[model samples]
Target: MSAENEIVPPPGAAHRFAVVGMGATGVGVFVALVRSLVAGGRAAGAEVHIFETKERLGAGVAYSTPHDCHLLNMRASTMSVHPDDPDHFVRWLSAHPGAGPAVESEYVPRRLFAEYLQEFFEEALVEARQCGIKVRTHKSVVSDCREDARGVHLIAGLDHFVFGRVFLCLGDLPSTAYLEFTKLPTYVHSMWQGAGLETIAPDATVGILGTSLTAVDALLQLRGAGHRGAITCFSRRRALPKVQGPSVRYTLRHVTEENLGRLTDGFTRQLEFAEVAELFRRELEDGLGLAIDWKRVLARPAETFTHTLARDVERAERGQTLWYSILDATSEIVPLVWRTMSAGARASFMTEHLSIWSMFRHCMPLDNARRLLGMATDGAFTVASELSAVSYDEEDAVFQVSAGGTTHRVRWLVNATGTGFALDCSDSSLIQNMLMRGDITPHPLGGIDVDFDSLRVLRRDGSHSARAHYIGPLTRGVHFYTNSFETNLANAHSAVAAALN
Candidate 1:
């Protein structure tokens, strides 16, 4: 290592803390750490180190979009940085003139949300500083992290910092399935990275590899940039996410504490997928205040997917849907529900129902859904499933995508399948180094193996790490709703509380 790569702590530092990624998750973890330490009167002489390769501290890749067309999938009223303060974000937005439109029930631009996050972190940082906490921000990536008797050591760029406790808030990993197409000029492996889309011609035919929310982002960006090219989105299941409906509070009967206790006998045994399905079915019927056919709701014909979208859009417009509210309630308790499942059941759910569950549970805003409907009606966009293959023509500098027994030629292809969490294929050197040494193992479902309650990493030898914890999406194997902002913040609070206690 070079001379500049080495870092030394000041003499007699009392306690040291490190947050490995300063995105939204990292920011949440950092704030929780500050709050925990301060509440316990342990903030003095505490050193908190934040590591992030990017210049921005709080936005992360998801909310850092510069494009105005990209909007938050959920309404602003429901998004709050702190779990205790449900309306904190809404209050903040109301005070800011640049928050764009009304705070509640509006799909504001994601860039503005990034601004909110930045300002939120800064406000918390001010309080942390008042408590005499030493905050160090590093604009470098952590290459490796290891723990021993002394403490946890993080190696970033050339510097090494030792911490009493470390929180791994590493954000989304890149899409690993597109590794073979990384070198191709026509292939856009990640739409979140830089201004790659700006290079494509206005009229260039583009194909997106998935029909999830990420694909919607790319489509909106293309439209915003005045691209009139033919856009085709392909996936193994060509189902798009359901549209968000008017906000309503729902009473969750089957998914409640009492029902959960009856199922688990107060956390005694593992759960089956069938049991969970029953709970979901009951909750849906109860919330809708009607008994409905389960088959029609769960399984729609591929040709009728658009029709379903239109029907849901009408429900949303009429404010007659309580499904989104039920989704929100389920999201709040997902960790508990996920942990109840046996490993085999979790794996089965991942293989069989995750795609469909995600499509319905994680829907887009109604306005965006309307735009999609209009696009489909105008023949400006088409979706296909069973995406078998994609190949590039070097001579012609275009891509040939084969999906649903048809081939389409396009000048650009986007891998919008979203992030994958396989540890072996991770891009982070920190994760790779830890996985190589068996410091952390991959969960059978996906993401890092961890104790669901404490958020402590489970070692390759089947022991939990004392000085290290994970508090982000990587814990999704055990916490299936890790993608939601509310879930991530809640997990961060739990991790910080456990570490402090």
Candidate 2:
């Protein structure tokens, strides 16, 4: 059997699984599925295939950075890809005992994480060998998933292929949020892709449109690249993230790490956002025990509470108000909160709060990840509440942001505004064609719609079938908890169960 296309068939004696998007989540899914099959005493009767667009597995956009400076924000103590094996990465690090303390104890470079993932991938493949289960890796974009009375057709260009089961673990799409700011060469975008870096010179005055984790990575990458510019980042409020506690001694504390669970409550959010301004303020100021670490709150949602709270309010009253509350609480715990919202909720929340959320949550880290509150001595980057918009001065080689009714123009600009899943504007050709051909439809609220049980995409008439399955950020509308390590693992396990059952 060849390495890339090793499929053993003794008159359909083995089961098959093909997972798409070989990023961290996809790899986790593949490993979990193969691991299950390998352990089930039916390993020899299974065939698993992996497909990726970026040449290799493990490192997608997140870990694919070709730089040493870009390190994960989460410390070495908490960055394992496997939830069950918390120290899998720590153990991996122990292999090189003499690698040094700072590199060992602190957050190591993303490249190190990439290496760990690759190592795990190889280990899983080796283990699956005895069961005749092989991961056939195809280096091509999966264009669409077409289904008839039979199975599913994974279309990639003119080539037609088939997979018994498919999982879409597509990661972050292009940061085309501010497409309104066209015609400016200095408007650089994409912290991960590095697509807009070439348009800027050493001293090009720049303005980053949003302030999220992506913004933080971009700023660090720029400084590492020796970018000598007056880089003034603007959002709805210029709000930088609150630094992780314990780094510097604080006179007072808000939310501690222990119960990072409350951030997921829409009930709490609704009760908080009932009115404006102060109502929101008191909720966040409550306490650490009452609230949880922002990310943990995000990863583990208070869904029952949210559902109960949502039941009381009419659909119309729920959206912006509930969204504002979630956005306010989500400032410190963006990614995890992001993990919990349904694709529709994410689209709505992002649509309504993109400018506001970016202002408060997406902030540039400088001089040792200093919290913005520490440096706003004279209000250089202080908290301000306001509305903002984007307008272009094409000939001037600039893009302007009209925040609080003042048009601030910058030399270089790129639409770092983020992605639009309007079906037509997606970066994934597969997604675009899927929407175009009715293979998938947007959830009523927003994002790709799916059935509540199987996590499979729902058609236009809202019917559920087992032929198609989706995972990752796209299914935010259905699962609400897509793409986290847990979500990825759960989706894969569920997908495998659904397929095999």
Candidate 3:
């Protein structure tokens, strides 16, 4: 471990690239790198490295979690590493003789997807090494990052990994942000806390603060664990994810490879919903000339950003006058609507547009949510809104909440308010460290303030990170549709292009 070989600052640091958080975004970037360098014949000459805190590379928090029963909102066929290779995943599934026949396109187990990604990266890494690309896997978290003329230097496990360019593939924060109910000990904080449902004793009354997919997962876990307790879920407006069912049109498979190259540009530039539907109808009839399943189209809006925006605009336009009512009534479509709003727009909309959301946004599932209602009607689980905690008497295991100024007392409360964001997070070592070192800055609650076009990191001081770029939720403010495979793939395509240049 001499000074020279002790992994000191290497030469040509500016030409190197270090990526943090090896989730889907990381996988996307890894594939993007191979595509770029291999295409340029510099694959072996390029230095690309990733620092991942997750137990394995390419399976950050999202996929790293060991929840198999929890199905992906998406089907396996759609989650491909290469945007151009539309059937990459489907083909992979088929090629894996052990995986069995082409069964129904149901939500695949999250673990299977994780393993698929793991295998994909391992193979890609081998290919990368064959081309002379240097791929380093550090099992540590990046506590901080600094930039100098040499480029971006990241502190991972006391070593400085310098890179000419950096891409952050970090996903959402740990669910513990909702520990507000636990400000007193009577509540359990961080639903991901060890089979979250197990915390509540059988027959004990507990409250959940969120109404999204996470909450549903927790509910399912609780029921599986045989907890006959009174469970209460609190959300300003809670919505259940739409179920998988029949569709009117097929999935939008372009936005990539062909870029619908076979189609016309007048085809998909919709900033609104009707325009999108019309484009799809026309494209299928005039170009591909077939009916696209409406169900599939709605379910897989993953690609069609223009269509998504148009849909949200349409949703908003219809409910403008009935704001709160619309949000309350259409509660089932939050995920879709949420996807459509830009990060900046989301922040602004979430704040001032509470009325719209309250009326239309949060929805309980008509069928699946019946499980929740059963719990409620049976007097075991109660769902409430506008809950406020009065105080906690930790010793006595009593927590109080006030809604509409009326305080309700409970033996315990669970803070399930949902994920913490940049604005709300101050103690995360990764984020705090990044902020302190001026390596990255949190954008206004809307997102990470990424240059929508370049995907470069916009510093807290209002400047782009000389070498760093952020992907995933960090870019939510700018891209709005980050964290999805489609968005990640798009980001990889765009940012890697910049890196190569």
TM-scores of all candidate predictions against the true structure: 0.95, 0.72, 0.73
- In terms of lDDT, which candidate is strongest? 1
Per-residue lDDT over 1-501 for candidate 3, one digit per residue giving the tens place of the 0 to 100 score: 566555444676755777787887788787787768899876656777878866777766567556544556555655777666867777777777545643244455566677788898888888888878888778887877777755677788778667788887776665445445544445566655444546577777666666566666677667767887667666554333323322122333322224332333433331233332343345344434455465653342353323332344444334322322322222222233343434454656557544333323232222334444455445655545555555666666676666535656667566555445544354467677766766566666544667766688777678886567777766755664454567667777788888778
The best-first sequence of candidates by lDDT reads 1, 3, 2
Residue-level lDDT for 324 in candidate 2: 32
Give lDDT for model 3. 0.59
Task: Indicate the worst ten consecutive residues by lDDT in candidate 1.
Answer: 5-14
Instruction: Count steric clashes of candidate 1.
Output: 1
lDDT of 2 at 491: 64
Cα deviation of 492, candidate 1, in Å: 0.6
Give the per-residue lDDT of model 1 (tens digit) for 103-221.
65478888878888898889889989999998989988889989875588889888987788899988887887878788887788888886568877898899999989998888888
Candidate 2 lDDT, 68-182, residue by residue in tens: 6666655555567676676767777778554345454456777878777888888888888866886677887787777663456677657676655667777766653665443
Greater-lDDT candidate between 2 and 3: 3
Worst lDDT 10-window in candidate 3? 323-332
lDDT for each of the candidates? 0.84, 0.57, 0.59
